[model samples]
Target chain A: MVGPHHAIKWLVFALCLTIGSAHAADPEALDREIDQLKSDVAALSQTLFDIEESVLHPADTQVAVFLALKDKEGLELDSIELYLDGSPVSSHLYTDRERESLRQGGIQRLYIGNLPHGGHQLKAVLTARSANERFIRREVRHQFRKRPGESRIQMTLDASAPDYEPVVSFQEWK
Target chain B: MQGLNNRMTFKRWALAVLFSAAGVSAYAQTGHPELDRGLAQFALGAGNGALALRYTQNAETEQDYLLRAKALLKTGGQSEAVRLLDALIEGDYYRGEAAFLKSSLVSNDQEERRRLLQIAAQKGHGEVKQQASYQLAEMARTNGRPDTAGKILASMDTGYWAALGYMNIAADYGSRDLNPSRALISLRVAMAMAEEDPNKERGEALKAQLLVRAGLLAYESEDYDKAITFLEKVRLDSYSTPQGLYLHGLALTGKGKHRDAMQSWHRAKKYPLAFSGVAESWLGTGRGYDLTGYLGQAGEAFLSASATYESERVTLRKLADMVREKGAYAALLADAGETRAEWFLADSRMLTQPRSAYLLRFMENAGNQAAVHRVKELDSMLARMERQEHTLKVLTSVLDERLANSASDNKPALGHVRTEIESISARLIAARQNATPGSSSVETIRHLAQTLKDLETSTDRFDKRLHKRDQRLRVLHQKASDALEKLDHRKRKATDVLRKANAALDQKFLAYIDQESERMLVALERAEQQIAHLYEYLALQNLGGGSQ
Candidate 1:
């Protein structure tokens, strides 16, 4: 004998009670949902970053320079300055790992940048201390044609010859 | 110019020998004053360029060509030097000096150099002949022709040069070949020849240097007693370099004389040689105490040494910067009060490709706090599920057992029997209440009472069935308890592995910090020493006009 208004009220009360019960069944559900949302956002952000990097630095125009030592015992490298086409590009003071790598006949990637295809002059200025405690500064220059692809330059300090002074040389990667 | 002077001096000496052989006593009257001045300048190791220029302009003798050749070599004119040396080699005078110089210059052509050295050895005079013979022997030895080397050495005349040659050979034998026994024999021969040399003071000085070399060789060869014997004979003031002191310390340490070793190391640290940093590092770390424990002091000494060398200092500084940066990040993570995921997110944002992999691994494994908590939650949930499953299984088995007992015993089902019993009890109570003392319904009441008693017996039978079911359920619960116990043990083992993995990661991080910092410190110290040495070298050059 309930009126339509009273029946609608009862229906609304029932719906609210059911919804409250469902929510109360698992209190940590909201927290888990929030964590999932955060994880998704982070993953999306990382993907975007990767895409940006790939779009910004493509392969063809990239140029890289590597430095190495033939014999580390005879010379203690202090610092090195690199110049491309008469403009300074990179200057680095050596780190222990870098020095150790050189001593162990390993090479370090010293500089990376982009360059247009053409001839370029690269210069490396190296400062080092000799085994006899003498400070020595050496400058080496090389002219290379960076064709329509990536260019790689390798600068090496060779101290293998016993009777001669240490020599620095440059080579281009094909 | 020095070459010219040396050849001129050799010519004068040869002339004197010839005059004496001819029984001429007035040879000094023929001596040239200009030649004497050149000889004096050559002896002082000065003005060789001017002397060579003068000789080139005059061009009077074979010695002048030799001097010009030497000057060309000094001035980086190697091709011109070689031509002049070839001319001298074909000439009559200064052939040995020219051949020796050519041998040094044409090192790539070993066979020709050896042949030239042979000619010099056969025809050269005084020290020149002795040096040529020694070099030929060295060449033979290096070519793996030991017999030829021995023969060459045997043919050499005993003199100051011969003594020096023996010492040089001994040094090669001991250091390069690791033949200490053979080196000792050569050293003994050199000592005997040195004692017999005409220049007593010079011979003794050379012998002392030889003794120091022998001591070090013996130390290297691990002949401690022999090393001590040789080292004791070394003259400290003239021959005690930092290396010598360091070696002496090692020898003392080998002999279990720690106090003496410490004393030697202390003295070694006072010198500004290359080994001084090593000595300081050793002393700073309590002479081989655990380096990990004394990292700060050890790093300081190492960095100090690194600073002495320009290249090494730069390297050390870079290493230090990297370590400092990484260490600060690690410290931040360690002190962070936030959840592991939050920390990881912040830390990973600053990481590059390969480094970011560490965070990914931590996030995946139970190595991080968040991951561990997640694992623990899963483990707890699994345990609860297992408990509920066990309870359900026990309940199902009890119900099945009750049904089987009811069927085998030909008894009524438990639910039907209980319902009947309740109905009978209610009827008996109603009938008793309705029956009066003289009423006709007394018989009906008595029948109801009998039905109630029978129902009570049926209820007791149901109780027995229920007791058997309870016993079976108890057995199943016991089995479940045993299974849960095994599960708990396995969980504990897995947790232990996780803990160990976390500990290993921490240890790796700590070790990276410690080792890189130590290396940076040592390199810094070495660079500082090298800079100081460079400065000292420059100052000395300014004061003395050239490197000593």
Candidate 2:
């Protein structure tokens, strides 16, 4: 360690064109503390993520809605709004990054919240820019029975062959 | 800042360019939608690799294997990913993608990587083909076979990828063919392509590299004005800026603006010596001082640079020792305080690590940054595992308390749900006694109640939500069908991910980071040599000037 005495000696060189590498010299004694926590962190991250989810929304009543835009070539999704049981729960304006990811078959979890067990209506309202350069608005609603223990519904927006009009369809995962 | 400019994939480039709408949807729908969802999670990068990997463990079809391979690419190592892709190499389905991904996985094996890349370039559709061609051409150009690279480059798409092709051509002309004028022209074309790219950050980085190359070429040709024009346009934050500054200073010296030249060289010297032009910048700085008649200061500056490089050599040795003993984490956390699995607290926590400023230049390699992020993620996962273990312990005690209180205390929570379960069971029993067709219902009830009872003795007893028998009965009726089993699966899956991440850290990340550190040490040694030469020159100059 350079104390006050030797510090002055450093500047006696007249010109110092140097970006000095200075830090508290990390020694070997403390290496174990971090090494013990290594690889353990990735597991803890996943655990905490799962723990946080379970704590916030237990699996028994958890309802997660996902969105997928599979028809990347025919339609450009500008924005989409989702409603659970007739109340707006999620809305997203698609960035080019997200949109392209979706085109490559990436499904996004749009909303994850609790729902009491029973039947509910999921309404999707979206405006997409189609090939004609016109903003086409579409509204679709589906009735779904929310089974106990983590109901995951993936709503896929696609364009049917020939006509290429936008269509929104829903699939539930076990 | 820009994370990985040089290695921007075709898909990354498309992130900014607004598409001019296609006629039809090109997405191929797989029968299993769950795999698509997993693919989505994989696309997000980090933290979700486990989720994607675990969910797709039982991948069957060619498509499934490919998706699982993609998940493994992020979460696991190269060998398993290669094994998975090997299945689809002969199959018609996803042959191109599988080949391209395999090429990426086996990138260390040059022969195999080129072979796979060639396959992908020939058979792959869309972005994969363009990217494979780009890689193949880049490799060929790097190997000094510009003619072969140019032939291969013709197959690549002429959008944003054209910029990279021109970059390869410029590289070829500059070094391989020794055609300065052709190299400058190629670089100009590359810069023009950068302008057309909608990805502004990537464009800036592309142009920066091109400008530096052109500046150097122009300066070498003694076209000081042309060099000045190209170098001045470089973005200050670009990775190539130090190199640009070095050449710009040289161009200024060519034009006899010694003071302005000194300022540029001084700015360049502020960068890490490991950077491409920083060593030359040090010599330039010393020369600028000599040119300006500060002979003593010139000697001092050279001496300072020499001492710094020699000290850097010592630091590199220490860094290597640190890595060997403590792994890459210690050196990375040199600037960090209280750094035990803390990067998980925030994804970007590693940004402030590595107290040595020059270490960041090594980390700027996309591969190194990814490895660092992976290490931090592993730390986060480990921390979470501890939390879960604690949670499991708490749940155990709570279950014990619930059992202890079961004899006397009966706090009615969700009583109606319990009554509903009791009523359903009673009705089922009555139907069974009367010999009715209710076998499945009766058996499911028995299965649920028995499983919950058995798990009561296990470490991971159900949470407080199922504390009371009535609540247990309610949950048993509601989720006991698969809840207990899935919870167990999840705990096991987390362990698997941790094991995989640990192996990956050792297999891929640790070795790569060490290699990068060694590379930095080599660069530092080169810088040291340049400084020594400059110091000798300056000392002689001072002596001659003093004699005059």
Q: Assess the local accuracy of residue B119 in candidate 1 as a C-alpha lDDT between 0 and 100.
A: 76
Which lDDT tens digits does candidate 2 get at residues B317-403? 676666556555545553344343322222222322333333455455565455455556545555555555565555444444544
Q: Which regions in candidate 1 have their CA more than 4 angstroms from the true location?
A: A1-174, B1-45, B48-51, B71-84, B157-179, B191-209, B220-223, B238-240, B276-548
| TM-score of candidate 2 relative to the true fold | 0.57
Candidate 1 chain A: 10-residue stretch with minimal lDDT: A41-50
Tens digit of per-residue lDDT, candidate 2, span A1-174: 789767776765433423221111122222222333432332333443443454456666678888876676778888989999889999989887667777767777778899865568999999988866668899999887665566788888888556669988888877
Per-model TM-score versus the true fold: 0.34, 0.57
Cα misplacement distance, residue B36 of candidate 1 (Å) = 13
lDDT of 1 by residue, B276-374 (tens): 234343443244221234434444544444443344335434533553454323333332332244322333232322233223333433334443343
